[model samples]
Target chain A: MVELLAQTGLNAVYAASYISLVAVGLVLIFGVMGVVNFAHGELFMAGAYAVVALYADMHVPFFVAVAIGMAFVGLLGLLMEWALFRPLKDNPLGGLVASIGFLMILQSLAVMGFGVRMEHIPPVTQEVVRFTDKVGLPVARLYVIVAAVVFLSALWYFLKRTRFGWALRASAQDPEAAALQGISITQTARIAMFIGAALAGVAGALTAPLVSVNPHMGHSVIVTAFIVIIVGGVGSLEGAILASIAYAFVHTFVTTFWDGVLADIVGLSLMLIVLIVKPTGLFGSADRA
Target chain B: MRNFLILLVGLAALIALPHGLSFSQQEILVFLVINVLLVTSYRLLTLTGEWSLGHVVIMGVGAYSSALYTKELGVYVPVSMLLGAVTAALLAVLLSFPLFRMKGFYFLIGSFAAGEIIRLIWKRFREPFGGVRGISGIDPMPDFSVGFYQFDFFEPVSYYYFAGAIVIACLWILWRIEKSPVGLTFHAVHWQDKLAQASGVNLRAYRTLAFAIASGFAGLAGALQGHYVGTVNPNSFDIEVMVFVLTWAIVGGTATFYGPILGCIVLTVLNEIVLREMGLEQARPLIYGAIMILSILFLPNGLESLVQKATRRKTTAKPEEKAAT
Candidate 1:
């Protein structure tokens, strides 16, 4: 039983890593643009597809394919800024509606290109690290965990230490004030979108081999990301990461003990309880809430 | 007298509409009528200036409730349908407790979380909800005869007439609510709740009232769908359906009562008849996505703006002529 619990804990850590990637991106976009990018999940799926095309089908190295996935999806983010977000800057609701439109387009394109069936990518490595006689961790999952840690640390450093980071944070806090300060709102928006989209894409690319990759995969991904971000607080990056970890542990344990649907119910209920008890979230800023 | 004549003519035309269409078109017409009710009720909720992401789930509540009532208790199908709407409304009132505490985007996400919980509940329990597969072989509306027309539940035309009557009546009540002083208070809340409160308005109660009424009518739409289709499932009330409803409300523009209805009717015809006939079944989502984007980009005010513009020009031109005289 101890072994089972430890194994589940390790599994949850891995789950939290990817979830944080997606949730953080969502939070960043919401903070900077004030629009919920419903297509954010599709951006993740786009990353996974990048892996399927380059690594699985074309024989590129896994890391290279993942890099391309992030960059490619980052570019898609720029396209969104240029086409949708920038135009609908004044109307957050309109931007949200446009994102929904983008989501459908991406999903349909995936269906047209890859067909509706799930894609199975070959494992990058067969090795598993065993902590005990019963407990094991796949090397691929470790890669995801490691990537999440490195990228998140890098993001933290950027947000804290860099001039652009200050500008980004300033803009997120108050766009009009940031504009008054001569920090280009347009430039900050572009940077936020690119970085946010890249995180989701990288997460998706890394996990593509480990999970069932399909056109409709983004639906559950977006739902989980929404849960994480909401529980973490809407616009707080640190809160998103923390909430992701907490949610991952509870959800993983629940799924292990009971069933998937029940786990989902529990996760949603936890969010509701948090909303009722503290509408701003556990670590959220009240001003933003 | 002229307005009453127009109403009579409109009702007659609507009643005769299915007769002109083919059998399959008749089926589409029934679904369209139900969608009209669905979108209009959604507009009712939005009148409080709250755009809920869970309206479709609330509608599903009605569907499941009505289905269970008729299936498990052997209640009269129509009466069960009414109970289903009540269940949805009561659920909305209850949900408003936690949901109304948050405003704007927080409210949107809160409502979404609340909805997912409800949907997950329906998925988890198989006894009543039938688990993931959902309840099938639900009781159909009993066949009957009106004095002038035979009402066979199996026929799409019959259900169209039945649902159309219900929908029209619901739409009338919705219209009345929108025109009433209570609706002005709702608009007040939407525009500026603080001011509305200063004027002695119970903001929370009014918001809940709007939500409950909207959910009730949405539930009625759901019950109509349930009896017509003879099945109910979690998949039927998924987020994708919610997206469609959202698109309809936006594309039609929610500024006017008839806006969403216009959007629903046009989109349904385009999606069901045109796209299906053109052998672009697989491309429906693609086309829908394109339309949504294009509409938001080019026609941000929605298709209703065009109608509003035309009417405004006529009224403006008439006033100028009268002023010259």
Candidate 2:
């Protein structure tokens, strides 16, 4: 029983890592741009397809493929900003609607390029860290945990310590005021888009080996990400990360103990309960609420 | 008189459409009506500046509820539909108390969460909603006799007419709301909530009322769809459907009541034609994405705006030409 709980805990952590990566990026984009990029999960999907195209198909180095995937998808994000959001800057709704369209385009492109079938990604690692006779942690999942910690810490350091980071946060907090402080809103937006896209890309690249990869896979991820961000509060990065962890744990546990369908129900119920009790989310400010 | 004639013509076309189309074509038309109903109801909610990304879930509530009640409890279809709509409205009202406190994007996300919660509940209760597979074999609307006419709703044409009538009725209600004082309050809230509040307007009440009304209409659409489709799956109410409905509204013009209707017709036809003719399954998303991008960039107000602009230009051009001459 203890071992089972330990295993489930490990699974929960793994789920938390990916969910946080996706959710934090979403929050960052929403914070800086004031436009919810509905195509974000598709960016993640594009990243997985990048791996499928490179490492799985061409026998490229796995790490190199992941890096390329992240950069490539980040570049796509930059292109989207340049092509869509930049022009629609005056209308947030316009940007959002455009992003939804871009999402469909990406999905179709994937289908055309890779067909509708799920692409199989070979496991990166077969080893496991044993805690007991019946309990163990898969090394692949451990990689996700380590990557999340390192990436999140790096993000925190950048946001808290770096010059560009302050500019980004300042712009997010108040664009006009940030500009008064000599911050370039355009540059900050570019940076936010890149980082946000890269985070989603990295999450997808890392998780590709574990989950079934297909064109429609982003649909679920995007929904889950939305739930996390909402439960976390819209513009709060800290809220997104924390809520992602909480949502992931609850969802994973429910799925393990009960059923996948029920797990979704419980996950949503948790969001409703949160909304009813704390409209501002766990870490969100009242002003934002 | 002109507007009345236009509406009468539209109603005539709607009533006669199913008879002109084949059975499969009639099915598509029914789907269009459902889409139109859902999208218009969505617009009704958006009037208060509360954009919900989870409307498909509200529709799902109605679909699942009606499907379950009729299939499981042996309830009459109309009664089940009413129950579903009321239940959805009640849920919307209950959720609105907390949700209305939040502004802009926060309200959007809150409503999204509410929709997901309802969807989850339906999915979790397998005995009630049939879980993931959803409720199937929903009984069609029964045949009934009025004084001089027999209506068999199971027939495609009959179903289309039934759905069309509901659409017309809902549209009438929406039109009335849009022209009423409540509609002004809704617009006031959307444009400037603070000002609306300062002027003694209960912003929360108006917003909540709009949401409840929209959800109720969504439920009605869902019930109709459930009976028509003969199945109600959890998957049908997922985010993709919400996005699709949203796309319809955006492409058509969210500012006008008829925008979604136009969008539904254009996109649905495009979807059918493109998917069938090109065999470019993958290209469909790309096409949709391109359309959305172009629409946002060039036609932010939607196709309706273009028509309005063109007509205004034509009207103004005649005076300029006469003066120049």
In candidate 2, which residue ranges exceed 4 Å CA deviation? A231-233, A286-289, B1-12, B145-150, B314-325
Models 1 onward score TM values of 0.97, 0.92
Q: Against the hidden true structure, what lDDT does model 2 obtain?
A: 0.84
- TM-score for chain A of every candidate model? 0.98, 0.97
Model 1 TM-score on a 0 to 1 scale: 0.97
- Highest-scoring model, DockQ: 1
Candidate No. with top TM-score: 1
Candidate 1's clash total is 0
User: B1-325 in candidate 2: lDDT tens per residue?
Assistant: 9999998997787777677767777788888888888988999998888788778988887887888788778999889988888877887787777677666766676677667767767677777678778888898888887767567876777777777877888888988998899988898989888998999998788989999999999988998898888899878887778878888888888777777788888988898655646786657768777887888788778887766666767877643332210
Worst 10 residues of 1 chain B by lDDT: B316-325
What 10-residue stretch in candidate 2 chain A is worst by lDDT? A280-289
Q: Model 1, residue A224: what's the lDDT?
A: 92
Tell me the tens digit of each residue's lDDT in model 1 across A1-289: 9999999999999999999999999999888888899999999999999999999999999999999999999999999989999999877688999999999999999999999999989999999999998899999999999999999999999999999999999999999999999999999999999999999999999999999999999988998998888888889899999999999999999999988888889888888888888877888884453
Candidate 1, residues B220-253, lDDT tens digits: the string is 9999999899889998998999999999999999
- Per-residue CA lDDT of model 2 for A48-141, tens digit only, reads 9999999899989888998999999999889988898889999967888888888888898898889899999888889999988888888988
